[model samples]
Structure formats: structure tokens, C-alpha cells
Target: MSAPSVPPQSDGGQSGRPGRKPGPISDGVGPTHRAWLEPLRTRFLAGGLTISDLSERSGWAKSKISELLRGAGLYPRWEITHGLLQVLEIPTWPMRRLWMAAALEAHKKPDWIDGCIQKVALTTGPVEPPLEHQAFTDLNRDAYTAYARVFLEDQEAFEAVQETFDLLWLHWHEALASSDVVAFAWPVLRERVMDRAYHSEDGHPELTHAAFNTLALSHLTDDDARFRQIAESLALFRAISRLPAPQLDVMVLTHLLGLDHAAVADVLGTPIAAVHSTDRYARKSLTTVLGPQHDPGDAPA
Candidate 1:
């Protein structure tokens, strides 16, 4: 019998079919695949989940998951890819786009690394701290109020506060990375970086010294009002972070640590008057800085 007839293929160049996968002349596949897969693997490992566990949750086969993780597979099908993301509980929008871009690049010869490579390429070195520290201090105070509100009550108002924080966080990081304070430098410098460090280490003598040094190096010079607000917020965060297990429980439960004035007073062996007064002051201060419109009485703490 005659051999089976084969369909003719088009070759743009003087070579094999144009549409066919290219040979060595085409981009090598290894690096292209690695670019996309490496970050996924890193993130998965960082999440502390096993591949098998991920497979069970995502409803993907072990081999396919492995292949995807290995960058052996470049196709970005939503079913499989999004399933993995759902299992991981990562926000899907940006991550999905990142993966899809990698997959498309991998399909071509001379494949390129993933989007992270481009991001890194665009990034310059570490950014210098902002010149006006007051801006950052103000931002920190705002962030603290927003964060505190979320901690206090699980209400729609708190949800709005959380969304605001999310935007601020992105803006802050961009400012830090780009050294561009005009945009969102205040929040990034004061709240996200400096204030947390100050409070967390303020109680620690060694760390406190280092924190001051960082403040100096970052050139964080601010006005007294802004500085005081940052200091107060840090104190609050520190108090919350260092509360004894019982008091913490009570504060969270009643306020966030739980317990109303009487309950907190009984637990701490303090008078209800003291508990109530302290709570009132804290709430008032928070509201005053966050927004005068916010009601201290309605707040959880």
C-alpha cells in the first residue's frame, strides 16, 4: 500500500513548515518556562502548603500541577490555573495576568522570562527617604486610625476603612520604591515603615536605638503635631501588641480584645471608672485624628 498522503505545510523561510514549531534557531524554552514557574513555586513554598495538598484543594492532577509549577506547561487555561489560585487564596486578577503573560511567552521560540523580570528591570535601586517627614507622619496617623477602626468593629464603615488602607498600602509601597514622596510618601515613610518600627522596638532598648538611627538616616524631620500623632499611634499599637493574654482577650472581645468597662475593670483589678475613662480617651484621640465625624461612642473600643 502507498504511504498515507501528507498535507502540504507553509514555510515563510526556506525551511520546514512556517507554522510548525521552530528548531534550535527558535528561542530556547528552558529560561522562558523558568521565568513563570519560579515565582509560583516560591510563593507556593512560602505559603507552607504541600504540592499534594494544593492538588487536592485545586482539583488538579499531581502531574499537571507539577508540570505547571515546573514551567513545562505554558498554556494558561483558567480552569486549571484559577483553580490553583483559589486553592492558594491569592487575589487572582493581577496574578492571573502575570501567569498568562508568561504562558504566552513560553509558547514562542526565544521565550522570555516572566513579567517579574520586566518589573525588576524597571526598578531602580533603593529609594532615598522623603525630605519632608511631616507628610509621612500625617499619613501614618491616618493609616493607624483606619487600621484601628477595622480592629474595633467589623462594620461597613470599617470595610471602607480597609479599602482605603489597601489603596494607601499600594501608594505607599510605590513611593518607597520610587523615592517619589510627592505622591504617597507620607504614608509609606511614617505609618508603614517608621511608626511600626518605633513602637514595636520602643520597649526594646537595643531596637529603640536602631529605630532612632533609621529615623535619622531616613531624614524624617516632622512638625510637633504630626510627630505627636505618630507617637500616640505607635503607643497604641504597642499596647495592643503587648497586652497580657487575658487583658488582650478582654480588650478584643469587649472592644476588640473584648470586655466592656466593668468586665475589663474586674479582670484587671481596676475600677470601672478607670477602664471607661481610658477607653473614652483612646477612642476620642483616635477619632479626632482619623476624622471628627467619626463617633467615639459607636467605635468598638
Candidate 2:
């Protein structure tokens, strides 16, 4: 079935009410909130599962799930969000926050206050100025290493890696909309692609593309080992993408493009001490999300 229609913006005209808001809900916040919620709802429904099915998987009551979906009554607690996220197998905090924000907004209308909410929602967690730079570089390096491990395992697993790359690519675009770090990393990404292609002995463009396709398709595989690896890579990328601007710069320079700490410091006009600190903090933060074992030291330095 086609998805339900979302509210559309109205042309600047009175809709038979004096100074009333133009849409179904006059509150300025409704449209923004609904916009976010509807997409998530559609995604859930598209999974071809019912609320009861979700409840069973998430261990939430069917009624609660329905209420959350309907955007009616009390806001869902983090436990509910966490439970549903577990059932969905979603691993990224940015994705979780995105959904949570949508769910929260569902019950309210957009207003001046929402601006602050959006800012907080989009901002990365606090990082000390000293540790901002190296953290991102380590993150990218770690991500690539993880990606390589997964890609090398099997052609099928390679597809899952590619799928993650596509998600990262899309997410990178989104990050660019809010920050320049992505823009800076684009060429680095291009270089990495070329490097991989050049290093491959097959030299067949189609086969190379197939290899990437293999990684992208990895998300579909049921193999436990491959599934976990792909999930891990995606989660890392998600965390890096959500990093605030300074850390993002470090990530692009150090990880995506493979610059050294000194180079990153020079580029950012920051001290090496600060760079080291940033790297440490970024790594620690990422480890918390990506798991301690997936530390940067574990990846190709």
C-alpha cells in the first residue's frame, strides 16, 4: 500500500480563518514534528510488521507501541526508545537521537524553542579542545580498517561494506549541509576509492565495482560474522558523522585523508598537544559507542 500523505506547505493565503495557522494543526511546530515522525513510521511499517510484532520483538506493550506510533498521549521514555531500537537492531546514537527527536517533536509544534532543540540534537557530544583533532583521524582510520577486514572476508560480505559506504556517503552529504568537514573529506574519499581500484590486480572496472557492490549488499546477509562486522562499521561511521565541527575536521584530515597529527595541527593552526588530546578523547568516545575492542590501535595506523 502507498504510504499515508504528509502535510504540505500552503501558499501564502488565508484558509478561511483569521490569523490561524494554514495547516490542519495551527501550531507552528506540528509540520516539522510530523515530518520527522512520518518517515520513521513509514520505515517501521514498511518492515511489513505490525505493532504487535514490534512489541513482541521489543518487549514493549502493543498498546505503548501503538501510542508511540500514533504520536498520541505521553512521550515515550528512553527505555521504550531503547527497546524499539534493539528490536530494530539499530546501533548508532545519531540515528537513535534522530528518531527520539522525531518522537519527541511529534507531540509538539515547531517554534522558536525548537531551534535550540535542533541545535542540541545535531551537535556532537562535548570534546575537550585539546583532543578534538586526533579523535576524528583515529576514528576514520579505524573505520577503514574495519571496512577492509569485512570486505576481505568474502565477496558477499564485501557487499555489506559497500552498503555501509553508501550510507556513509549519504550521511556525509547530510553532514555537509551543516558543516564543511564532509566537503573537505570528499576528495579523500575519492582518493581512497582510486587507491583501492589501482591496487586491485584484476584491473577490471566492472569487477571492482562489483567488489564495492558486494560490500554494500552486506547489510542483507544473514551470516552472523558478516552481519556483526557490517553493523560495527556503520555504527562507527555514524558516530564520526555526528562529531561537532572541530572533531570533524580532525576526522577528515587524519582518518579520511590519512594526514598525520602534525599535518592536522598545522592545517588547523592548533598545537600538537591539543591534537593528541583530541585524538585521545575522540577515540575514547568512539570506543564507548563502537566498543572498546574496536579501538584505533586495533586498526591500521
Every candidate's lDDT: 0.41, 0.46
Per-residue alpha-carbon lDDT of candidate 2 for residues 14-109, written as tens digits (9 for 90 to 100)? 232232111221233332234334434544544445566677778888877776666565545556655654554333343444444444455434
Residue 102 lDDT, candidate 1, scale 0-100: 40
Off by over 4 Å in 1: 1-36, 73-76, 108-301
**How well does model 2 score by local distance difference test?**
0.46
Lowest summed lDDT window (length 10), candidate 2:
1-10
The alpha-carbon RMSD values of the candidates against the true structure, listed in the order shown, are: 20.7, 20.0
Candidate 1 lDDT tens digits, 11-67: 223232222111121133332233333434545655556667667778888777776
